[model samples]
Target chain A: MNGEIAAILAMDGIASGAIYVLIGLGLVLIFAVTRVIFVPFGDIAAFTALSLASLETGGRPGTVGLVAVLAILATAVEATALVRNRALHRLPRALLFYLVLPLVPAAAVWFAAGTTLSMPLRIVLSLALVLPIAPLLDRIVFRPIADASVLLLLTVAVALHFALSGLGLMFFGPEGVRTKPLTDTVFDVAGLIVNGQTLLILAASIAFCGLLFLYFEFTIQGKALRATAVNRIGARLVGIRPTSTGTIAYLLASLLAGISGVLIAPVTTIFYDSGFLLGLKAFVGAIIGAMVSYPVTALGAVMVGLLESYTSFWLSAYKEVLVFGLLIPVLLWRSLSFSGTEEEEAEE
Target chain B: MKNSIVAAVVAASLGIATAAQAEITVGFVTSQSGPGSSIGVLYDRGMKAAVEYASSVGAEKVKLIQLDDGSDPSAATRNARKLVEENKVDLLIGTATAASTSAMVAVANELKVPMIAISPISVAANEAGDRWAIVMPQPPSLMVKIVVDRMKRDGVKQFAYIGFSDAWGDLVYNGAQKPAEADGLKILTNERYARTDTSVTGQVLKMMATKPEAVLLGGSATQGALPPLALAERGYKGPLYGTPALLNTDFIRVGGKAVEGVQVSAGPVIVAEQLPDSHFSKKISMDFRAAYQKANGMPTSDGFSAYSFDAWLVFLDAAKRAMATGAKPGTPEFRVALKNAIFSTKDLVGTHAIYNFKPSDSYGVDDRALVMVRLVGGQWKYAP
Candidate 1:
């Protein structure tokens, strides 16, 4: 290929890789903190995109109904568990977090669904509507099984992906949605043309990565999460609540996924089940990181995006196979390198 | 209301009203909850409209049993078997994707029952030469030939090809080769993408590098919009051509401005109003439209639902002929008679095409079945 074509392909690759980076980072964060694979991470992103599209088109996003249902279920589960543990004193706080917090955004969406809101407000509303899904799912599905084997949690996560996708269909319907671009500006970088949205995605990815680094290095809660990820037993001994750390991880990851969704909505059509494959591709990036290092995961995800773009150009029919096939060699190398190391099991 | 009344009047004039006591059970399996549901829902609504119209017309009583296969082939097979063995359905009609429909075709032959498939399966799978099953949609050979012929008329010497990496894609691509060769046109590249792929920039870039005269897409429904959107982004302004699969409202809506001026080979029913009033399919297409609106409370915008409606029409015709032989419903003799009647059908008009099925034929249409429509300002306009 000529230099121009190669440059264009690289641009496409980096743009898509940026999306994978966000998703990969979220997957790695959730897996480390919660010992849950969080297979439905992409679903959250897709829902966010769908929600944003709904708001843009003056329709009530089905995310409102989904978040409302999940919030109530979470509250019921939390309430029953607390009452059984004789922790009635914590009930009000639980209600505030589990019920009232998510409901505020849902209520906002319900009231503002059909109005011609500004694009920024619509985006914020979409993010707010989707932000609770992952954390509330933690309360409802993962928290009770917190001490279960990592394998079991993984199985449950996979099952939850199917259930959520089915629910995605019920909520969003079958038609795919692609929103208008956030901006119409185009840039010519020495003969390579780049759209404003691509620049936004690249900017967002870099900003989020920098923010994540700063937060981990400088913040108390971030250190707590890091400690929990490093050693759950040691962290517990140091008075770190695993459940609280898990919640924080989920919330942060949900935000990342939501941001990715909003960024991606205009670039591609978002469907109810579209998230699974996208998430799976990001999971490959996480695997390249050995499911821990954030920078390596981001790098790996970008590699995947570049590799996918190149492969599609060279071998269009086998693009998915080639992209997914990279996993085998990475897994083999990881196994060989870490053969004798004793990894901490997720189970208590 | 006016349309349904017209449909009723047409039904009365046709004299298809049969004895209500002789009931025929029809089993319909469709994708109601999975990836295929986008098209499956159309089939579901079409069958519902067909059932409603038949009842209003005082046709033979039909006990319609519908099941959701969830787009799984094994589930479709299980559902088909259950309908035949438990419900004793006289005929079978669906399950949306080609894979599931092929699975049902096997079940139909194995269960010794006649079936109508609403999706296109590979001819190898439909090798049951004795014909216990037949396809409702036009074969890719017939549909793609029109697109190729149009390409020839447009003075295009070569084109790029991009489609889904699946059976449907293979069907369209394979169907295009012979006609393209006959027309002396070259297909420069064959690129494929998954249905759920969020982007096709890589494929589009590859195609653009080849610099073909035009592009032909083998994708359908919402996924079909991907390549066009990518091409438009790259500012590739050559004409686009596709088959009947691209004739859906979601495709136009999703593709938006990028898909404007795309020419697609479609069933006559899609542009029913644009068809001359003397056209054979015009009256039935109008009736089907009215019946669909009355039953579903919305207009039918895709070509898929008409397949189901045509399936019902064929079944109704066959059922009437089968009963004329004095065979009781739910018996093996009745099924055999029904199969024979369906195979011998000649000049039977429906919304999409006039079907003339023979025992050896898997598909039952000719060139008269297709019309070319171009996407103009977000609506499919009759191009010819």
Candidate 2:
């Protein structure tokens, strides 16, 4: 209730909210680009943290095995499609993209296992290990039904989240882990000490947002993704392949999740099942954006963080109820504001 | 005719002797794959160690039929039913969480089999006329009383409370109320967080604003470390206390420097090596450690797992008495005998506590079941 305590709580809220923003951005981006909700975004984030924890302990991360299995599955699916289409010439490209590229990080992690690596190296390796998961999951689970109804895709994505969580338990052994803080510095401003980790998290969130803006505004690939997000069929008509754009969306979104994972891991314990709740909280932010606007989503995510922090201060037991309760009013508002939008056309 | 009657009596006696040596099947249900899996795996490991120990020590062959409930209560029910009706187990033990354990309680009663519950269940669950379940772990009230007693001794008037927002949390919070009141202590705050909550900064901040002399956490396993870590981050240095649920290696590993000096009330088995030589639990606790190391390939490092070991000890004792009644292992008569024998368990020594159960009692341990422990240098040191 006091000014110093309020300031500290704000710092905590913003720091955690920044993580939600990162995850929300990924959720909104993926939802726009591929009509899939990408429920497993938080799982990827959690896996990144677990990977870093494994690296810190000088053990082989389970991500290597997970990515390898996904890569093989994706490759087999692609190879079978190629043979069915009698496009033998495209086989080599398929093998490289599906099989070889995904395995590189797994191999790196395999080689890095049990040897002491610097923290920066471990973070990079963790990010790389998680990068292939979302994209390859797209190939194996989402590609065949790429044009399916949004509801169906959402169900599949949710199921994939559970499966990955179960796999996470198998690999991580049910113990929660927290890595060492990225920085130990603290700042004193007006009689309040602010943790350096909070500053780093805010900085990372802002930097990623700025970078994403630049990529979307300046880069051709990013524009292609935006075009697909705007109109999948129209983008395809103009020569942008939705499949490639979808893959790009997954990769970029996963990078956001990966970064958020690394940022949040030191602050709190991350477990195999921890991702679902985080992702769901961010989804509340995404819903506020109507699954469309990035800035609105980011703002809503921060509001959620602030709301959560304040609510917990006032009513700790009902904190989750209050945080999740925001969605009802937001959904009501979204429905009122976006009533005239036409639904997507179903393609055979 | 007399000679034929003598032969028939001899054959029936041989049949009864063979039945006494038959494999006694005991079903184990535990959460192996869900949110509860962290604690569930500990129970599973302890049960494995118990099976090995029983085989080596007892003359009777003990067959353990294990099933994973995946932390689901309904699944626990199904597994318990399968174990009893199909496998025809003589006794039941399992499912780590209270809800799932309670789910198996009904099955035990309806199926006429005795169950040794490893988790604390509500009083209503055991209030049935034909109750067949008895708890292994110390009741939360008894454990919380020790914490409250220590608070009284330390001259602490009020303390902040943070715990999981589940039944376990409610159990601890409610358990502390009467004891805390009697000890002239006041509870300042009641903050709760979920097991999967990534941060408890909000809850911690709220609790710290009250500025109590100490903090008592009702959380268990790895999640128990969250509040302490939050408190440490804010540099709130004060005495911390918790129930036996906090006495685990994962709690220490995750809490790290923050949890040091925090005292917890736990089963004496946790600090077995630190106990006096004459303590009743000391020998069995040491035996449990050896069996655990042999079976799990590591030393026992948790308090939850030992409950399973103790449950096994109780079952072995009761099953021996049940067999003395000349009932076949798979028959209904043997289940009744086992149930009666379990209810009559008296003065049986186990790793955690000396066993004593009554027909109407759900929890059997007294004050001897608990020990106050403190974390120093990342190890639980016996503080009492």
Clashing pairs in 1: B29-B95
Question: For each prediction, how big is the interface RMSD?
Answer: 2.0, 2.3
- Model 1 ranges with Cα > 4 A deviation: A345-348, B1-21, B31-35, B51-79, B122-129, B294-297
**What is the C-alpha lDDT profile of model 2 across A141-252, one tens digit per residue?**
9999988899999999989998999899888877788898999898998888788988999999999999999999999999999999988888999999999999999999
Interface RMSD of 1: 2.0
Q: Residues B1-384, candidate 2: write the lDDT tens digits.
A: 999999999989978865653778889999988878878999999998887787622466777889999989999999999998888888899878788998898888777788989987753434356678889988888999999999899899999999998888988899899999998999999999887776788888888889989999999877899999889988889999999888777788878899999999988988899999999989998989899999999987678889899999888888888888888788888888988998899999988888898877878898899989999998889998
Candidate 2: residue A122 Cα off by (Å): 0.8
Give, for candidate 2 chain A, the lowest lDDT window spanning 10 residues: A339-348
Candidate 2 local distance difference test against the native: 0.89
Assign candidate 1 its CAPRI class.
Answer: medium
lDDT by residue (tens digit), candidate 1, B137-168:
88888999999999999999999999999887
Candidate 2 residue runs with Cα over 4 Å from true position: A345-348, B1-23, B29-41, B48-75, B123-128, B293-297, B324-328
lDDT of 1 at B226: 92
